[model samples]
Target: MEGRQLQQVLNTQRLKSLQEWMQESSITLTQVNGQRKYGGPPPGWQGPVPGPGCEVFISQIPRDVYEDRLIPLFQSIGTIYEFRLMMNFSGQNRGFAYAKYGDPLTASTAVMTLHHYRLPEGGCLTVRKSTEKRQLRLGDLPTSINQLELLTVLRMLSDGVEEVLLKMAGPKGREVVALVNYSSHYAASMAKKVLAQAFKKHYGISITVKWTSFSKSKHVSETGQEDGTFTPPGLSPLPKPSITPPHLHPKPSLQDVPAHPPLQSFFRAVGSPAGLPRDEMKPQGPVNRDAVSLLQWMCEVNRLGTPRYEVRFHHASSDGFLCFSYEVLIPCFLIPLYGVIQILPGPSVQATKEEVYRAVAELVIQTICKVSNARPF
Candidate 1:
């Protein structure tokens, strides 16, 4: 019995040494792989084949699902390194889970086979690759805010927002919340700081930033669906037009106002105005005193149009351009031709202002050209 115990001890020590060696070698090999990829494994996995590191994400899961029900189903594709189903405060399945696999090939195989596989529950599952990059979600916001207001506040946070998943907390028990997913954690952190400061000043609400993940439970209240942002309100549902309707909402009439360049003319070959009269294309007066009201219509158009343009500012006089810091052109009818693009507006500014104007014109023209091809705006 003593000799047997001694042999067992020796075997344990040998296994420990092998594990330590493998760990060290794996680190070294990872370093040598040029950071982007690995050159196989130095010693490689001890199994019959090599494995690649990959993570899989699953969504649309039924509420009754549990980890036990998933393990067997996932094991058929490849060995699972880790499995996690996001949970809510009630510890219920959030209807989404992430599984890390030993190899990308195996992960791919699993995704292909099980993307629409029906579970014992009523819903089917959707599977895809997991992103190491986190999507930021801001929660605990006051429910009164709208998406435009939310986006304005968040833009103060960071310029790195590739996309944002924004939400307003539901009424009743629902909290006003916003989720801002940035391209990087560093970006997310900076956004939290900037938005916190801006929100306090603008909305008088204290904003909390969180690395947002989906709530585990799929069940949501009707108000939650409306307010929580799982399904954002339709474009028309935004705040109604505040502008008093134009005494006569300008119709596309040639008799009253200049004929609009035909949509076809604008989209035709470069520099081609089709056959629209040039004199008619000139400014039709300073967009009327109802200019302020016209802005609301522009905003509405932006909301409904693809490649939307948010109205940032309006410039009436050239002095307002400098005093109000409206450095850019008015960007509406008549202003581009009569205001900014007009020759010798002022010699007081920089001599290179002409060059700057040319560059800006090029950029604006390119943008218009590209946007014109889109559905609208």
Candidate 2:
């Protein structure tokens, strides 16, 4: 048992069982948006919401280390108003977390004292003040949205809304964009995550919500960079929009039309024969194909060798959806297609990985259909 415990501590990638973790940690944690929380405002605590400098970001943490060890360690520096450990789906820490103190002074003390502090296991931690931006930029809003109406809707969707300013966007200034300020960084962060889906579901309109740079009221371009990223100079202009080829569209005869083409869910992994849960990351249609069966069919159809998948989780969208970049190497294709797939974030990373495989399989069928359709008789 001692050897097992020691190995668990040493294996940085090991995932701990929830039962084993609960026995070791006393703090009740709630998981959301890929972070594990322990008291954003701890129980029996009453004071103003923590502002800037009240939180410290800690990194280089060992994966096996959980809140039981971390919370107590930071608590030594000062009263911990909150401690959030970024968690992995497989029960390991994401190697970084944030700790909010009761005040700016205590948070500063944590960084001064604990930056580069050596752990008992001989690993060093990097601690610094958390950089939490408290503004969000909303685009694709109704052209007629007034400040009062948008504010009313925002308050209904999320808390900590301080102010809203509408801007005329697009070349003709027909589109409306809004900049929103929040009372606290946490509120802004949470709002950025939920607002996108909230508007779409409740109002049946798609809107983009992302962290904004208050450095300036807006970007030089009227539309501004999307997802909070700036486009550098000398980049090729975005490709002209082209109508999707008819063959690429979901055909009833193929028996493998993809679900959620925008999300690139491809075929969207459906349940297998064993009563497995269907992948409802998005609303999917009837399950006509699984990855394995689809891949086998693709191979037979193309007379190609085995297919290969090279994929990695690249980044998370501003609204908390996970994005993965993938390269599908097919023996028949001279150039393997590279693409990005966006998936709704969830606890199971492995399951998301499997979904990517299914997506690739469905994509292969689409590509072949397009090729076959284009060939001259």
Candidate 3:
């Protein structure tokens, strides 16, 4: 009876242990699956948590690096939302730029991969997440400046002009606040200085230039209220020449020739009595169709399919020593059989017709075998 009691006690303990283990296992599984529910990292993750902001600041840019050359480098890593080179008022690159990626992950990737990367033109890039926002504005312009004049000034200021916004503050649209968007901040900075100088020289007023936040300019563009105010004209027309030049002589025309004889006869009538040499006037002979037919027959007999090819035979001397060259399309898979069959004389003489045919047949068979064995990559 005691032994039966002990066995029962042992059975209960075993059951209790099993239940506890199952409960613990269930809790472990729940904890693991609930990780994402609380916005935790996924399983097997091994990297820094992605940061905010898609804009990256790039410093130490080469002076010659323009938008066309700069965008491609970062674009290879991810989609580029914005590329801007920082420039000075003199239309010179300030050796820095900003690139905004479509996502923070992409921006992070570009920073990690390209930071301290050496540029082709001679500078190592200093790439990092941008903390400060950039704004590009050209303020305090002559109110009378039209869109055409603004464009002209901007063009002379720098290249890579993406968008131009002109806000007329005063009456008669005389005081213009020009918002210029360049591919790079470098370009914008350069335009500011040059434009100020140009405005002072052209209009005799000290133009005020300001670099505002990008958000302000972007908002003005997206609203579309000022877009149609002034349609910027095409490139400024070239300046006219100072002096008029003499008229050029008209070229002689074939239609003006006399109707009695054709142009060829007219030329002959005016030339020496003796005509061109016989060799010079003679036309080339027709291709030897017989040789082509023979080669085609051989190819067909050898089970070589109808491949696009050209064959030409030349008979140099009266000795009937014929030399021929041919080109045929061979599938890439059969390239291994390229030199399998080459026609050659037994000792030193030229290859005979039969020998050439035999060689071609052997080449075709080898090519077929190679193609049959080839496997797609």
Candidate 4:
């Protein structure tokens, strides 16, 4: 068929161009784990390690497209500190990559200028800020493992192992766990995929890896701030940070959520759905959303699991209304989005909790909308 022949011809041309670039030494190519790293701190590049917000997450890449085209496109915005193209074993991109610019300004420019930019093959790319977490919580190690020995073995097994801190985790602190700090987010992503399996295959030991809810640098003492309030490790006192827990399910269900803990609005009095005043239940502005379905679709598209929330109903304010705040965290997403919502709860505590759930669900749909097109309900 003509289409088959045309595809072959295109592949041939791409292969030829890649070969020429290699021979000319215009780009460096190597394999790290399963990725075909195109240029890391590219050739003749004299620049310090890129700072936070310098990298952008790129998705929906066409499989056949290579760095032969992507690098130059991004270079138009600013200097590319590093670019990594994820690849499949069969010699095509896995349809996503990461690009870190020389500075946050340049990276922001690239996201604005190039997101949804159409490729020659007719697929639009999704580009956004990449999340950076330097530390990974590694669990299920041998009890007798020593810090120095474990550190050395980890350096051999994982790329960019800056250092490892050992602590006891499971079952009365009988298991050894390691907190691994990587030099870059790219390194952590790469290591997360393999550390467990690598440990099993090579060392005959098994382990588990997780993204720590709070980075080591962010962890604080019980008496954290100058204010006398005792801020919990992951959650702030009020109107600030809230602790979120990741789900363990590989494919989480929308209905598979935590028990509904009813919440109340501290500052405003809202009656139950049957008797609550209409003004309190509805927002002043026009609103529309099919939150439950959209959340399920989003989870499917981005490879995320069902979200888990940390809801708290606080003591009543002086105005005689109960207080409430909720934190929603969806597992398996690179982006750690924090959703904020302010809405009147229904009269009873249960109605308020449901209203809060829907509000936060819409917030999630809005937050991820830039990274994903809203599919029709």
RMSD (Å) per prediction: 22.2, 22.7, 32.1, 24.3
Please list the residue runs of candidate 3 whose C-alpha ends up more than 4 Å from where it truly belongs after superposition. Answer: 1-55, 58-106, 112-135, 170-175, 214-377
The lDDT values for all models are 0.42, 0.60, 0.44, 0.59
For residues 1-377, what per-residue lDDT tens digits would candidate 4 score against the true structure? 97686566457677677778667756777776556775555655544446677988788887788887887788889888788777766677777777888899899999999999999867999888876556677777666555544544454455555556677655575766677776666666666777776656544566797656433333111111111112223222222221222111122112221122112221122123555654354332111234643564456434465455665555556755545565666667755556345565466444555565666667767777766675424
Best by TM-score: 2
TM-score of each: 0.28, 0.51, 0.27, 0.50
How much is 150 displaced in model 1, in angstroms? Answer: 2.4
- lDDT, model 1, position 15: 41
Lowest lDDT 10-residue stretch of candidate 2:
240-249
Better of 1 and 4 by TM-score: 4
Which is the winner by TM-score between candidate 1 and candidate 2? Answer: 2
- Encode model 1's per-residue lDDT on 31-117: one tens digit a residue: 110111122211223221122237677788765555545655786787765565554433345567656666788888999999999
What TM-score, to 2 decimals, does candidate 4 have? 0.50
Error of 2 at 348 (Å): 36
51: Cα error in model 4, Å:
2.6
Q: What is the lDDT of residue 7 in candidate 4?
A: 63
Task: Give the range of the ten consecutive residues with the poorest summed lDDT in model 3.
Answer: 30-39
Model 4 lDDT-worst window of ten: 220-229
Prediction 2 TM-score vs. true: 0.51
